[model samples]
Target: MDTAVTSTPKPVALITGASRGLGAAIARELAPTHDLLLGARSADSLRPILDELPGATGWPVELTDYRAVAAASASIARLDVLVHNAGIADLGTIAESSVDQWRNTLEANLIAVAELTRVLLPALRAADGHVVLINSGAGLRAHAGWASYAASKFGLRAFGDALRLEEQSLRVTSIHPGRIDTDMQREIRAHEGRDYRAEDFLTASTVAAAVRNAVDTPRDAHPTEIVLRPF
Candidate 1:
């Protein structure tokens, strides 16, 4: 036998909102096991993750830009994992919420996710990939001041449910994690006019690990929905 070596291809994982906070943590967690494609608003936004995970590539494309997302998806012939972690939280009671706010929330959280997933179906099908939707507790129970955010998350929950039912060859998991200790949480707390306590929220690493667990689970086991809370 000749002295030759065959390199094993690593699984591919693309994570949005991966520049900082929970997305970055997820990127770090999956870096060892997957070939990461970190997505953010701009290539510059992904620089931090690129620095953290040397093997990861920065994929800058606005998730809402259908044309851009489609073009990006076209290049992904085989995707092992697609983690939808990008979203916005605009806190306002239903009465105080504006039409624009609702539209923006839905557009960022639900529509973009749907569109991205739709375009990536072929790549996902080719690899029998996993889709992880980083939902929130708001997705399950709406709070008073989180109308727009909750509605978007609720819509996301429905989207994931439908996708799971439709994509027979792929695995879909809607991770409804409670408030994580991230910049987003800081903003939400500011909206509440309260002091930020890191202990009160779950860690980003914890949530990332949960996502990894879902992805690494045996193919025979389907992790449809997983709820994680701080307590």
Candidate 2:
């Protein structure tokens, strides 16, 4: 008897917060093979990067808005990978944090991730795509005056874990990347000082490389989660 063989399809990846920092890095790293849909709140920020990459489309959508995310998701074809890297870190203790600050943190970090995943799950399921959640070390450990940001990340970690189980066939990984020297980290360092050591910081490109590795790994194998911290 003779057996037939088939080639697998090239994957498509949709990344949130692709304007700059880690999101932009992931887009650049994945541009070689994946058809990319880059989503962010600012169209201008994405235009230059999208212009440089091939087979990449830029859609400016606030992930916090479920309707906008849903509409944006509808415009895309089947997705082979989903990277949820868009997040905001608002600094404040639980008591000192304003109500608006807490709301904004939840909206940007937690709610947006959940809603965007819900919107994009169908497309991902159709292609057996992977979902990557960009979380933070704050999620795993407590810190001073980091209540809102920490809570948001913690929620995201739990959400990703639960979703991974629900989508047993799809690959879902939550990554805890310690202090990357992005604007986000700069802000945190400005307030925290030596607490966030400058020498012990990873570049956005490094995190992007990790994301690419996760996506490029064999489909038959799934790495549940990865914790990447600067050594």
Candidate 3:
């Protein structure tokens, strides 16, 4: 008698802004169990992460480019997870902010996210996927100098809330992490004229672990939100 062995196909996860920082950490966390589609603005930027995780494929597209985003999302027939992590934080007070600054911030952080999620809805529905939005503490509280960035994040939180209610079969989680110790955080510190201290902020891996835990939660429980702040 002959016996046959079958192997299960790994789940697929697409992570935007996966070339570095928290996005890259999330990719590393999920790489062992999920086949990854790592998104970055350019193939050159995504190369190092792609090399590190041989199982992942590069998805190079500007999120603000709706045409490019739609084209890229079309190739995915069944997506198990979609992590929206790409965003910009051009910090400025309302008095200092220009029309162009607000437009660019909203375009990258809010509009692009909505468009990408909209285009990938069909694929997500097919697999009863989980959508993870890497939000920020700014989403919950607005600081004086962070008007534009905070507004965009607040809009994102609303989007996630609406999505969770709208898509009954899918799970939508909004992860509100405080200032993380990432390259972005370094830039933010520089902008504020504060000394960069990695110890003062949440590590990318710690936040990434929170994401993985949410993704791994039992279907019976819905992890709608996860808030992480450094102690």
Write model 1 residue lDDT over 1-231, tens digit each, in one string: 798899999999999999999999999899999999999999887876788788899889999999999888788999999999999998888899899999999999999999999998999999999999999999999989988899899999999999989999999999999999999899888989999999999999999999999999999999999999999
- TM-score for predicted model 3 compared with the true structure: 0.99
- Work out the TM-score per prediction: 0.98, 0.91, 0.99
How does each model score on lDDT? 0.93, 0.86, 0.96
Model 2 spans > 4 angstroms off:
1-9, 193-198
- In the range 1-231, model 3's lDDT, one tens digit per residue, is 899999999999999999999999999999999999999999999999988998899999999989889888888999999999999999989999999999999999999999999999999999999999999999999999999999999999999999999999999999999989999999999999999989999999999999999999999999999999999
Sorting all predicted structures by TM-score, with the top scorer first, yields 3, 1, 2
- RMSD for each of the candidates: 0.8, 3.5, 0.6
| Clashes (candidate 2) | 0
Stretches > 4 Å off in candidate 3: none
Model 2 residue 179 CA deviation in Å: 0.2
